[model samples]
Target: MNKVVVKKIEDKEIVWFKNSNSYLVLEPIAAAILLKINKNNSLEEIKTWAFKKITAPKKVVKKFIEDIFLLYTVNNTLKKEVQNNSGTYKIPTKYYSEKYYSIHNCIFKIQFQTGFHLLKIHPIFAHLETESQNKFHFNYTIFDDKDFIVFFKNDAFIGKWNKNETHLFEGKLSMHLIIDIYKKPETDWMGVFHASAISNKKESLLFLGDSGNGKSTSLALLNANGFDCIADDFVPIDNKKNMYTYPAAMSIKKKSLKTLLPVYPELKNAVEYHFKKMNKTVRYLPPKNINYHLKLKCKALVFIKYNIEVELEINSISKIDAFQQLIPDSWISPLEKNVSVFLEWFLELPCYQLTYSNNLKMIETVTKIFNNDL
Candidate 1:
């Protein structure tokens, strides 16, 4: 197996250009692997080096590599890179919060803020990096061969981890921080919808479709061409009705290459197959305006359908019918017993069901709707 090289780019992202066209956003475990392998170290040397650094048993180092590789296989999209034996590099951190944890094709870092009962990943704005740059927000006293805990300012929450239960608490606490602390607030402040939000300057278009309906593919194609990609799989809309965006960019699948090739011929070889479940996958973030936040209402909703016979047709559906079609695709569902809030939010926006055959003409058809204000 060849050693892969890792380089630190931007402030948060780590790049491994040799493996795949896209960058692998590192978790602490991945970062630790990179630190173990410098440019000169061979695979055997890496095993020996790991044993030297930590006073573990002889087989610990070998198993460590194997276990981490398995993790990447099951939970990570970088499984192909590891399988290909492309030498990889990682940036290590002692303790980081999962809220700021941006894994390759899986999650997004919504917001990183400190509270009385929360653990944080990034520095608290500024002020204390010089004091103890390695210090963490929460007091994480647990350790697996691959996991580390950073202490947080939340004294009460930190106290929950009794000695025997510390490891379990570390995983639980990270999850709690992400859901109760980060996602709950962000979802309220910005209504987090499970749809792709694509925009130019004047008009922002949203594609609300059932899973595997090419929601992510359409967004990726638009992004590759010229328009801004707000969010590939999930969109964030503010309380005052402004939509904020985050970067979770990926690419289209190889199977769908025929649909996209007519519109954008550049993605021929660029189409990489990701085994993960996300319909919209970011293979690379080429030079394009990544819209971090967009203050636009849900101007138009287009339901996308792909087939061989139908030419691209964007028809105007009645408001009631539009709401019925769009509701099913929303993050909130009628299946949930309590859906008042979701129905309220849904009524405020305009909706459309766009039916089309698998041709490139849908782009122009949708463009005309925006022009006509239908």
Candidate 2:
């Protein structure tokens, strides 16, 4: 059932919030269309309501519902909801299945069902198969010699890719392969960068770095110590220019876990390589004062490099240069119109670089920076 409790966010529009915090604002008619489909109303009742109140043609209402369903599928948040609605068949229904594969911190989930191949996904990935599906010059099929193939609609692939021993399903897709996908010509055009972000209040800190420069490990250290995580690997900035933080319930691998063990004592007995290809296993500790809806205004850009010393050095960097490096890592293409809006949001933020060795020194350095300057 559609969650159709529309509230007036501002005088001009009504907003609908989903359980996952994803929302859509609608005009009066769209709101009415949505309201008619709320859990309280049956499908027949909804059609009756639409026929009476909607001045738009029946086709328009049908299109709206179809588009809504597609959006729900692409977002993947509908899976559990759809599962619950199985007996009703209240709307057209589809099934989804995913399989997990191994290859380091990378995780990929391939989703497929009996009917049309609608690929539901978590937002962390850049779709290589979709490259051939661009609107300007769409190709329904993508092939890699005789070994692999993928199919699509528009720029979003709606089919599967298969290779020996490699299966894609509904979990985290291999992040290693996902990362590699970002380097291909597809990603070269789509653009992928390396950055880590943390948010508090309305401010976010994007940590930019090259591979193996310790971005993920530093994020783990910060998470273990005190900082709340916005993203471990990537932050998806929507085309609307709004930035959202996707949180993962996993630990990062580091050369030293002792640096974190003292802060998160439960980690002392936590399992190793517990599931998937995740190398280090650390128990999740609830953030002390954080909630999922906490939205931070991006405040800083920190370029980090790991050192083995006992000291920390923090310095300012040029915002112009920082933007150049930071925008690419954004999970969504910043070149999109809305992305420019996000770029503006990011540029207004402060930028810095932290060079540190040892966990204590790194914590001390960040603490001082937060207390004194940030």
Candidate 3:
């Protein structure tokens, strides 16, 4: 009974729904049910239509519709409040300095107290602040009765904040804010990729792999060899297929400290963080000679695998295979034109699978591939 916009992305095998400021991804069957909803359609009519199309039973369809209705109602209410409260804020108990930054022309204002040591360690954002109009902003402040809170412009709390333990909470809040500002529906970016990127100044190489597959290690090695590090974990691709550098600190695991320390002596002073989820100790190090604001066209896609028992090797793969491997880790924009342009740029790149044990051999193989010698 609610008004919503539904878009079918047949190429991606997913349907997108935009309800106010919220976006939801639904499968074909669920999407069909959503499409059946209209101003005139009763709940029984929608259920009857869904049963005719979907193979599910009457009870399953009923539950599905109930879930969708709940989600839609909750998200719609939040979206309306967020939109109405934009550019308005309540005075905080403690005011901090507001810093402005420009990323792909989208402005973000981050306000944090000088005592918040977490902000000081994030050197990647050091050079990004400049005189700019604020498009999105969040304020970090502490209260007399409560703990620290990162408040949205509407004074809505971003997340749970504690005064005693603040590092991990603030770190997550910062990432959430970054994603919010960069991945807005009105932005021109195609989408975000869970891949690391490095450039030779002329063209960029994107390294895609699973979470523990050495993407950051490979990028660190390339950076040590004079390649410009574009992004460590998430790469933002514009509508034009240009990859923008996300200069977040690279998280290097303790296992890699022996090999990477030789190349980057600065890692000796890097702060150690124990990631409870991964059960690993990591050091967040700033990429070497990184330009915080740089965009490069992707020239190659490499799927990397690090194996202690395997010899170094690089093999070419078809575009179809590359796409199949990349789709799982990629968050493609629901916009039809954006998806088309991204596919064009992606298919134009040469794809390769690189397996290696030693970093030196891996570097050599990558260099040869880049030079067309492989």
Query: lDDT of all the models against the reference?
Result: 0.48, 0.47, 0.67
Which candidate leads the pack in lDDT?
3
Candidate 3, residue 159: the lDDT equals: 48
* Model 3 local distance difference test score: 0.67
Residue 305 lDDT in model 1?
A: 66
**For candidate 1, lDDT tens digit of each residue in 1-374?**
32333433223323232222222445444556654552444668767666766666778768876665553334323343212111221222432233323222223232222231232222211111123223333332322222222233232223233334443443444333434323444335423465777777666777877766777677766666556776655565545556655444434556567666776666664534343434444233232475443466666777776655666656666555555455443443212112333334555556676666643566666556567644
- How does candidate 3 fare on TM-score? 0.62
Of candidate 3, the 10-residue stretch with the lowest lDDT total is 10-19
lDDT of 2 by residue, 304-350 (tens): 88877636788888654565465444443323333334445554666
> Number of the top candidate by TM-score?
3
TM-score per candidate: 0.47, 0.47, 0.62
